[model samples]
Target: MSKPNGQEANHSRQPLLEGRSVSKYFGGLAAVHEVDFAVYPGEIVGLVGPNGSGKTTLFDCLSRVQDIDNGQVLFKGVDITRKKPHQVAHLGLARTFQVIRVYRKMTVLENMLISRQWRGETLWKMLKPSHKDTEQRARELIDFLTINHLTNEKAGNLSGGQRRLLEIGMSLMPNPDLILLDEATSGVNPTLIETIKDRIRALNKDQGISFLMIEHNIQFISDMCSRVYVLNYGQKLAEGTPDEIKANEEVIEAYFGT
Candidate 1:
C-alpha cells in the first residue's frame, strides 16, 4: 500500500468521476474555466487553492448545485452535468458544504434519519416516519463516527468538529460511491482534526468510498490525498502527487507564495 493517501492499491483504470473542460461563470466573471480533473474509484484526491481560486465553485459544478456554463461532468460513467442536485445524489454522489449543513435544532439521530427525507420517491411523501433499516443504519454510522454518545444531543449543541462528523455521517447514509468533501477541517480543533483524518482514512480503506476534497489545510491534503489539484483564478494551476506538487514552482508562486 502506498503510504500517502493510500494511492496505488485503490486506483483502477477508469476514473469514478471526471470533469471534461468543465466551466462555470458568474455573470461577467469566469469563476471556473474549462477545468479538467478526475477521481478514480476508491481513491482520495485533493483540490487546493488560495481563497477565491475556484475550489468550492468547482465542487458546486460537479455536485450539480451550480449549472456549468460549459463542458461535462461524469460520475460513475454517467453524464451528470444536466442533472439536478438530488438526482446526482441519488446516483451515488454526495457532498458536504464549506459551511456545515446539519439541522441545528434536530438531534444527531434525527439529522441522520432526516437526510433520507429528500430522497423520497415522490416530493409529496413528506413527514413520514423513518424505516427500521434507516434507523439502524443511522445508529451504525453514528457509532462509526464515534458520535454515538451524542446521538440524542441536539446538533446545535455539538462542537464544530462534531457537526462536521455528523454531516459526514449524513452523506454516508446515501451509500455513495463518491463524496465531494468541502473543507472537512475548517474551524475544527487540533484534536478533532486528527480524528477526522483517521476516520477518512478508514472510510477510504475499509468502506471503499472515493473522495474529492476541497481543503485549505495543506498538511491534511498531504496526508490524505494521493493526487492534488491546484486552482488559481478559476483555472487549474497544477496536478500531481503530493511531493511533486510541493516542488512545483507555479504552485509556489500562485498558491504557497513562498
Candidate 2:
C-alpha cells in the first residue's frame, strides 16, 4: 500500500512503453486519433473513458492487435509499430482481452502449458524431457494465481472470474515487462475482483512488472493505479494521479455529460 516511486523518478527513467500520436481508423471513423500515451517502468497507469471513447481501440493499437493508420508505438525505446502481435509478445509485452480468450476445450493445465510455448516449440520438442522447467514454471504460476486445484479441469467449464484469473496467469507466463489489461475486473464477482487486484499489486511490487490497464470500474482503478489517463472522443482528455482525474472538469463531463 506504500506508494511506488514518484512521477519525477518515472520521468527520469525512460518509459517502458510510449505511444506517440497513435491513430487508428475504421473506414471513415477514427477509433483513436493522434493519442499520446506513456507507461513508465514500474507504474500502474489507468485508462478510462465512456463506452466508445476509444479506450479499447487505443489498447488494441498499442498492443498491435489492430494495425494503426498513423503514429508509432515504441517499447523500450525501440519502434514496435511494425511488429506483429507475437513479435510484440516476444519483446516482453503481453495483454489480456476484454473478452476472455482461454482455450475452452483445453484443461487448465494444458492452457498453462500452451502459454509456456511462446517460442513456438514443436510438439515433439514440447513432449521431450527438456520442458520440465517450462512445466514447472507453469505450475508455479498456476499456484501463484491460486488455480492449482483446477489444473485438470476444462477451462470451458470454469466460471467467468476463474477464466479471467486463468487468462491473467497465462499472460504472466512470458514474464512480460508490461501487461495491458482490458477491463480485467468486468463481470467478476466482488471477492474475485479483490483477488485480481491483489495479484496485480503483487506482480507490480514483487516482480516489478508494469501495467497499463483499461477499466470502467472507477473504484478498482482508484485502488490500484498510481497514474491515470482519460480519453474522450478518441483524444487525450486528461492525465494525472487518480485524485486529479476525479477533480478534473473535463473528465467529469466526458463521463457524466454536462
Candidate 3:
C-alpha cells in the first residue's frame, strides 16, 4: 500500500516471508538444501533457475504443498513450516500453480468467489458474510483485473489468459498478505502479459501484498521486480537488483553456456 518504507531507508526491516535453512528431501535426494530466502512487504522478488534446480520444490515447501525434510518457514513473524496448505491459507498465504487452477463449472465471478474457502460459517449462515463478502470482493477484483466483461461468463469458456487472470483474482479475494505465483505469464498471449504485470503491480502498490514469483521471461523480471534471486542446481547463485543479476557471471554461465 505504502511505498515500501524499508527499501529506501537507511536499513532494511525484517522480511515478511522468511525461509530459514529450508531443506527438502525426496527419497534421499536433496532437492532444496539449507536454503535461506526472504521476501519483504510490498516487494516482488523473482525466482529463476534451470530445470530440476528445485524452483518448484522450494515453492511447494513455502506453500506446504510438499513436506520439507528440514528447516522452517516463517510468515509475518511466526513459524508456519508445519502448517497444512489450508492452514497456510488461513494464515494469509495464497498461491497459484504453474498451470492455472479454476472452476470450469463456475462463472468467472463465481470462480473468484470460491477462493474464499475459510470464511467459517454454517451452510445457511455461509451466505451472510462469506458469500456476500466474497461477491463484493470478487466484483472489485474482476474490475481490477479488467475482466469484468467476463464476470458472468463460464470460466471454461474463457481464454487461457482470462482464466489466468481469474485465478489471480481468486487469490486476491481473501486479501492475502503474500501471494506465491509460480508463473503468472506462462501460457498467456504476449499482449496480456503487460496487463497481468500491471495488475500485479497495482495490488502490490495499493494493497501491500507481497509477491514471490517464478518467471522465465528475463524482460518481464526486469520490468516487474525490485529484486531477484537466481537458483542453480537447487542453490542460490545470485541475488540483487536487475542490473546486478544481468551482469553476474554465474547467472550467465548457468543460463547461457560459457
Candidate 4:
C-alpha cells in the first residue's frame, strides 16, 4: 500500500499505529486475514468495505477487544497485540464501539468525569471533591462538541447523534494519541454528520490526534480521509486515496456487483 499526496515522503517516520500480518479467527472461520495497515501521526485514515468485510474485526484486533490469531499490533513502536484492553487504553489508545456505550443513568458531566478516572483510583478519590481541573477540562471538551448545554442531562435522554458526540468526547477524556472510531457518522443526520466531521478535523489539526475510522459513508470518507484501505471477505483488497478507490475496478465490483 503506497500512500499518495506526499505521504510516501514520510515513510521514514514511524507510524502511530501499525498492523503487521495481523489475523483473527473465530473457531475455524477467519474473520480477519493477514492484513498490513498503518496510521501515520496526525493522519485521518479510513477503512471501508461492504458488510462482513472485516472492517470492524480489524478495529477489534487493534483495540485488543479481540485477540489476533497471528501477527502483531504496534502503537508508538510498542507491541500491544498481547496487552489487555484497559492496558491499551492506558497506553494512549482509545476506541469507540460500533454501538455507543454510555452510562445511561448518569448525567453527562458525571459520565465525562468517570471517563477520566484511572483504573486504580479508589472509591474515596471519586467521593472526594471533584477536582476543579478535571471538571474544567471536561466542560471545555463538552463545549467544543457543542453539547455543554446537555452537561447536566441524563445521557439516556440524548439523541443518537448527541450520544455519538458524547462518546467521542469521552474518548478524549483520556487524551489518547490515536482514536479508532467505529462508524462515527452512522445513523447521524446530515447536519450533525458535518459537525462531527468538522470536529474530527479540528481535533486532528489543533491537537494532533490521529484517527482510524471505519465508515460506510463514502462521501464522508472521501472528504476527510487522506488515505483509505478497502477490505473484502477479511482481506485487503485495495489501498489508496478516495478518488482512486472510487475508480478501482475491484472496489466497484465488490460493492455493486457490477
TM-score of each prediction: 0.94, 0.94, 0.91, 0.93
For model 2, what is the error of residue 88's alpha carbon versus the real structure, in angstroms, after optimal superposition?
A: 1.0
Write down the worst ten-residue block by lDDT for model 2. Answer: 1-10
Q: After the best TM-score superposition of candidate 1, give how far the Cα of residue 125 lies from its true spot, in angstroms.
A: 5.4
lDDT of 3: 0.82
66-107, model 4: which lDDT tens digit per residue?
888999999999999998877888888998889999999999
How high a TM-score does candidate 1 get?
A: 0.94
By lDDT, who's the top model here?
Answer: 1
Tens digits of per-residue lDDT, candidate 1, 118-180, equal 453442343445467788999999999999999999999999999999999999998998889
Model 1: ten consecutive residues of lowest lDDT: 118-127
Full candidate order by lDDT, most accurate first? 1, 4, 2, 3
Q: Estimate, for each residue in 96-212, the C-alpha lDDT of model 3 and write its tens digit.
A: 888788989889987776677633323465457557766787898899899999999999998888888888888887678998998888889988897998888777767777888
Candidate 4: residue 133 Cα off by (Å) = 2.2
- Give me the displacement of residue 101 in model 3, in angstroms: 0.8
